[model samples]
Target: MYQSKYPQNFPENFLWGGATAANQIEGAWNLDGKGLTTAEVVAKAENRKKMSMDAVNEAVLATAIADQTAINYPKRRGIDFYHHYAEDIKLFAEMGFKVFRFSIAWARIFPNGDDQHPNEAGLKFYDQVLDELEKYQIEPLITLSHYEMPLALTKKYNGWADRRTIAAFTNYTKTVFKRYGKRVKYWLTFNEINTGTWGFHATGALDQDSTKNEQLQLRYQALHHQLIASALATKQLHQLCPMSKMGCMLARMQTYPATPNPVDVQAAQVADQKNLFFTDVQARGEYPNFMNRYFAEHGIKITMHPTDQQILAANPVDFVSFSYYMTTVTQANQDGTAVGNMATGGRNPYLQESAWGWQIDPIGLRITLNEMWDRYQKPLFVVENGLGALDKLVNGKIHDIYRINYLRQHIQQMKEAISDGVHLMGYTMWGPIDLISFSTSEMSKRYGFIYVDQDDQGNGSLRRIRKDSFYWYQKVIDSNGENLI
Candidate 1:
């Protein structure tokens, strides 16, 4: 017999889980009394073309009407999790998930953003899903809103650009907290909320046709409302579910200087600050001062109600959560071979790249964990992290070894970070079961241990096939991250 040597693995009480957004996994977009969400308006990307997200964005934001049927909206039909949740949750339990992170579709609950009450059928659908998760003791980490803002709000109230959206959001928040707060303890106010400015469509609110200056104004103004709404939701959640812990989710892409030049270093620092500024407001309970200078420099002024500051200051989050896939580089010049999803950059010469061009640096995960912990001193939850890749279904099975290797390396870095004194919460690999891709709005780019028999053109048997990574991840969780292949 041979004995192996390794460091102490994941904490005994560490959370092991998978994540899916309701807008990304739950089909039945208009089932029951659900109304159209902003996500339903974006058209699918043509997979035949090179992986150019700009082409997808052109079709996505160019048509902003609430009528999803008129356009080819991929998210409108996401793997049908609404109906197949029982089977999906069963699969998750088989892998021994301690928690499952999913977003709540606001439009499903409110139908219209400003509805007087929630749709009963939409509420009941989640109840059934929650019931299934409870059967397996899988705790739910719910995001109040991902990229799912009701289209009605954007059309009627100019999205979050108008402060009234805060009121509507709080109404929806209060309803959900009352309904599901007892069953769910972990909550995130928004998914990648910073995207209101970073990526227009990520918030599903910003209009793409607007002028550059107009986009800048609307983005910042809209962000103010979301920040207020986030704080208000935190306060309301504690009142409704005193046992609950609320978190703020960000799309965190650690940045590096392209060269050792002082100019590049300064640019990277500014970029990093810009990325953390939103989370700082939510987690620290106040807006950062650099934002004021940023607004002035951009020729934008954000108006806020007198109580907005008080609300934010009073309701800081219990934890901070974020998604990290790849890191980017910022330089004095914007010219570069860019790569990635939320944030792009010149290729990291020391690393590999995913088929989608995302630079793969597992060590960046450890660096990010340490930086976040040191800055905020809060327990961090990696609510989203995974490799989006091209997978082949062979012999009625998908042997996704690349996906396995990606995850294994990331987990090793996570273990390293945990050992380095980062107070980590849990890791929920994004899209455990392949669903519609948010980056390109195509199904071909997958990040799942469980394969959903679907295609970019929305053709397949909707079957769930366990990929090779499924068994690998199962063992990792089964051994509490002690077993790594």
Candidate 2:
């Protein structure tokens, strides 16, 4: 059995759970009147390459959007979650999960960006899922959008650059709130909204052929519009579901200075500011002055309506939720070799890395919780945090002790954060069951307590098998996070 050192500090109401995104896990991409989605092409696995950001921005995105086909999308056939949600939810219940964080695919509900009515079949699918969770007494923390906007919106409106998308998204939110708001009391407006900065391909929000300057301008403009949309959603959520909590999700990545030099230290702060930029607006209800200077410095002008500013200032999210994967190091000079560093990277020497090169930073989780709680003074939810690695199926069993170690250290830090006076609502590691990778789009890069029988080439029986970590996690949750080995 596992035991926490600070058992009294782990709040009784603290949520012990896991998370999944609709686009990453739900396989019925075109089934039941569901239209095509941005994720089908842009976040498709075959489209990814381990290369520099310049190559990705200039080539990979253009090629993916220009030539992507539905068949190449592994997410289209994800572990067959659409057909096996009951079986999967049963596994989650067995683990004593209190909550499950997932997103409602905008394409599923709206079909296209602008639809007169929601498809009943689409809504029915979620109704069944929510009923299953309710049966288990597990709460649902729903994210309104998680990288699968309708392809029609991306093609016609350039995602969110045109103001018309704001109306379309608002319409979608209103429909879902009316349908499932009572069942799901917690909501996040977007999944890892900060990812839109560099991973615009995933969001389908950028035009491929635009010049560098036009790219940044369009990118921030889209972000500005999303900031507006999230605020509006918060207002709508409060009015329709007075008992629910609404939050904005961010990808929280911490970067330390590569060297002790003052310039490198200052550069690290700048990089951190870039990551916090999204929350600064949503939580504060207005863009910070630093963002204004950033926009001017980059020659990016965000055209906002008079009411847009008021909408933001008047409606701040009720809470803040974020995902912490790993922390990289920042340096004064940009390393052209780094793939996805926010500003730039000089690899961290203190930490060990996953097979995918993401550093293992358990302490960073505690730092993130404390900083976010101090910054927002609202409840914080650690929505997603886990390690993805190669798993070996040995005689019908998986020994993923690396994943167990990764989660155990992080949970210990989480208890420390609770003792530090952070008003944390819950903790949900990234997909509790195996699903396609959001970054590499490969099922081989697995991060799940329950392993799904699948591979990179999309070959497997779609079977679920409990790993050693699954039982370990069950014990931790059964003890209300009091147990951690």
In candidate 1, residue 333 scores what lDDT? Answer: 68
lDDT of 1 by residue, 1-485 (tens): 23374445677878899999987889898789888877776667554233322232335454645344623777888998998999999999999999999988998889998888789998998899999999999999999988878878876776787788889999999998888989999999988877777534554454567777878887888888888989989999988889999999998979999899999999889889999998899999998997787888889988878888899999999999999888998888677555655565676788887777778889999999999999899999998889887888888888888888889999999999987878888999998999898866788889999999888767889999999999999999999998887
Displacement of the residue 67 alpha carbon in candidate 1, Å:
6.1
Best by lDDT: 1
Provide the overall lDDT of each model, using Cα atoms, as 2-decimal numbers: 0.84, 0.83
What is the number of backbone collisions in each predicted candidate, taken in the order shown? Answer: 0, 0
Q: lDDT value for candidate 1?
A: 0.84
Q: List residue ranges in candidate 2 displaced over 4 A.
A: 1-8, 43-70, 336-344
